[model samples]
Target: MTTATTTAPPVLHLAGISHTYSGQRRRTTVLRDVEYTFERGTFYTILGPSGSGKTTLLSLASGLDTPTRGSIAFNGQDLSHLGLGRYRNKHAATIFQQYNLLTYMTALQNVTTAMEITGAKPATGSRKARALQLLGDIGLDKAMATRNVMQLSGGQQQRVAIARALACDVDILFADEPTGNLDEGTAQGIIDTFSDLAHQQDKCVVVVTHSQRLAAQSDRVLNLRKGKLTEQANTP
Candidate 1:
């Protein structure tokens, strides 16, 4: 008799993903045959120079775009086979360097909007409360939660973006240059928040960053060069 061996499904998987864009004059390949896996409760940082397809890779992993020649799977389900919008809403959330919050909206409003968009089952007030709670968790206070995003500093705005991402309660968080605009101390604080999210909250956190400090804080570091991926050795 032969015993069957089962392999665990990755929380997120990318297999041979490739992407290209065609313009009138030339075609440019952004990602090339990339493959990686992210498990729950782990923080991964993808590091590379500018124009290295880091953001493109994050978009594809988050189901924002379809791969040209490969597959992305979430818990054994193919991303292409699922409803991409619903998949993104339920399984992943993205934070960008720009914060992407409405300038006129309060921090709580920004987070609640994400929760509403994701179809989370909570009353508006409850959602706001949860949003505020998340903001507090990320080191923001209630006063900041009620203030307009434009009134906040850059680091504060980025913290709000992180709170908004967490509001959706998705299994995976995709962040693109989340600390690009902050100072060293503030950036370190943000990295600590991400670490807590992955270790304490059991979330899979993937960040595309160029900062060595941020890479050092992650559970694993993936280096992307000209769209290819390799694991870095010095990750914590």
Candidate 2:
């Protein structure tokens, strides 16, 4: 008789992670024993007030910063053991609040640059096609794709940023205040797009937001206060 073995799903895990900033005479702890597990197909939001270490948590989760203590693992592999730059390029993507696109590059060029950063070797025609497709997926049109980022509005620039983040086919996406600059309606649209990406595409979406609306839309809402996390009940 032949038997089949079942494999566990890949997850992002944080175990007793802690971070401290050392000053000349004192040390400030930014995170304390943070233990959380993030799985695919879920929109997870970390909600916290300013200086509550939410962004720091994102940095650690994305392998942009190392913990002062404990470990962060992705798919059972320790992130500390991996080269962070490569880890970010291959497995994780980030969208910032300011929409960090190259001012000189067109929307398509920005997305194509992201694909190139991931070492994707698509042909020139294919790369442009993929970039345009990504833009469309994020609700931008071909004309918008060809426009320089500087010529776009805030919301439009943010859409291009989202497309760039999606260009590399990353398993995990980290968004920091993704809708901080948008009006309510625009913010709702962006949140909806993130929701679809998480639920439909089966990607792990971690967002750091102070917006209750965004947090409510997530599958799980985690509250970070004074360097600790607690799940919020009654989240939408």
Candidate 3:
């Protein structure tokens, strides 16, 4: 007897997504008829020139904003039906270049704050402990996690943000210019963390980066031009 085979559904899928902004004088189209599928266990890099809508695509994919047309599906469910807030809370996380953490909160506090919104109650330990462990996983020890985010270096703060994103316990991570402020070595370290998150932890990581080093490390490279997406051969 032959056993039946099953394929896992994509963690995220975008079909014919387009977005346009309207002004009194003119209507501007940022994205047009873009189609893509993202699955777990892989990292994707989006490359595009400035004003090419790379950020716009990331925002839409992470449920920060909805598209003007078309659909985004999360875990096989239509995103529109999932509700944007629910989609972000349960299925996705975004890490911005600005490190949009609560400025006055400690690293740990920022992480736990995200948990509060997601309504997560860790089964193992207190929420704070879970936050510390997550920071530790990203190489931030207790002392670092307890420090105010303002005191941390660029790279350290980025890791703390990554920890916060992980604390959300979602399946997809969206990062925009994540390493823009770091030095070469620190930037590489950040990229390495993203790699491990996708390949080892089975998260679907989508990063918008201008760094070739970053693109080279990703499992797939997508080029955005005039609001369209085309796959590029992965560079060794």
Candidate 4:
């Protein structure tokens, strides 16, 4: 006789999440009682039309902003109680379309700086070796890593950004329009990198994008409309 063990809870749980803006004339609601759970080892895509509050959801999820109602928890701990700063520093990392790399620093330095800010524990491994290894993992050669971010191609810069995020060694990765500015080939490469990170590295990957191609490649496609999330069936 054998007993079955229960799996751990989701990495991220959104409970009745809602947000709104109050103006002198009136109030506008952006999100309406949204519920979602994002688990590890999966890549999920959130798609929506313009002004549909996609960025707002990402902001709240990343702790860049708070919801007007409801709560979000990571690893069964409320984000509010865990503290947004600590959560951002120690629990998750985001990759943005703009790359957002420090213009003054080389690619390696950019990653090194991010790890330093997060104060990544030594338990995760050595900062220098880890940064170099991460950059290599994402297809950036040592020569590219040594160049200033401004000197690298868009695709190269994005890879450095991804490396920086991974250097944090967080369980969850959030991306916003990551391939928006890249060419078709470059975009596909970036998408592939994300997929590898989710499937092989076991990082919970969530991307907010308008690209249907991206959604198609994801393990799950979620449509966000007027503040609600609906799972989309795979098109035949």
Q: Evaluated with lDDT, which candidate comes out highest?
A: 3
Ranking by lDDT: 3, 1, 2, 4
Residues 5-81, candidate 3: write the lDDT tens digits: 99888999999999999999999999999999998999999999999999999999999999999999998899999
TM-score of 4: 0.87
Each candidate's lDDT (Cα)? Answer: 0.89, 0.88, 0.90, 0.87
Residue-level lDDT of model 4, residues 102-158, one tens digit each, is 999999999999999998744556787788888887678888888999999887888
TM-score of each: 0.91, 0.89, 0.90, 0.87
Residue lDDT tens for model 1, 1-236:
99999987999999898999888999899999998889999999999999999999999999988988899999988987777887898999999877889888999899989988997745456887888888987678999899999999988899899889878888999999998877777678778888988999899999999888888889999999998988997665
Runs with alpha carbons beyond 4 Å of true place in candidate 3: 1-5, 121-124, 137-141
Clashing pairs in 2: none
Candidate 2, 1-236: lDDT as tens digits: 98999876567999999999999999999999999889999999999999999989998999888999989888888886777887898999999777889999999999999998897645456888988977887678999899999999998898888888878778899999988877787678878878888999989999999888788889999999999987887755
Error of 4 at 85 (Å): 1.2
Off by over 4 Å in 2: 1-10, 120-125
In terms of TM-score, which candidate is stronger, 1 or 4?
A: 1
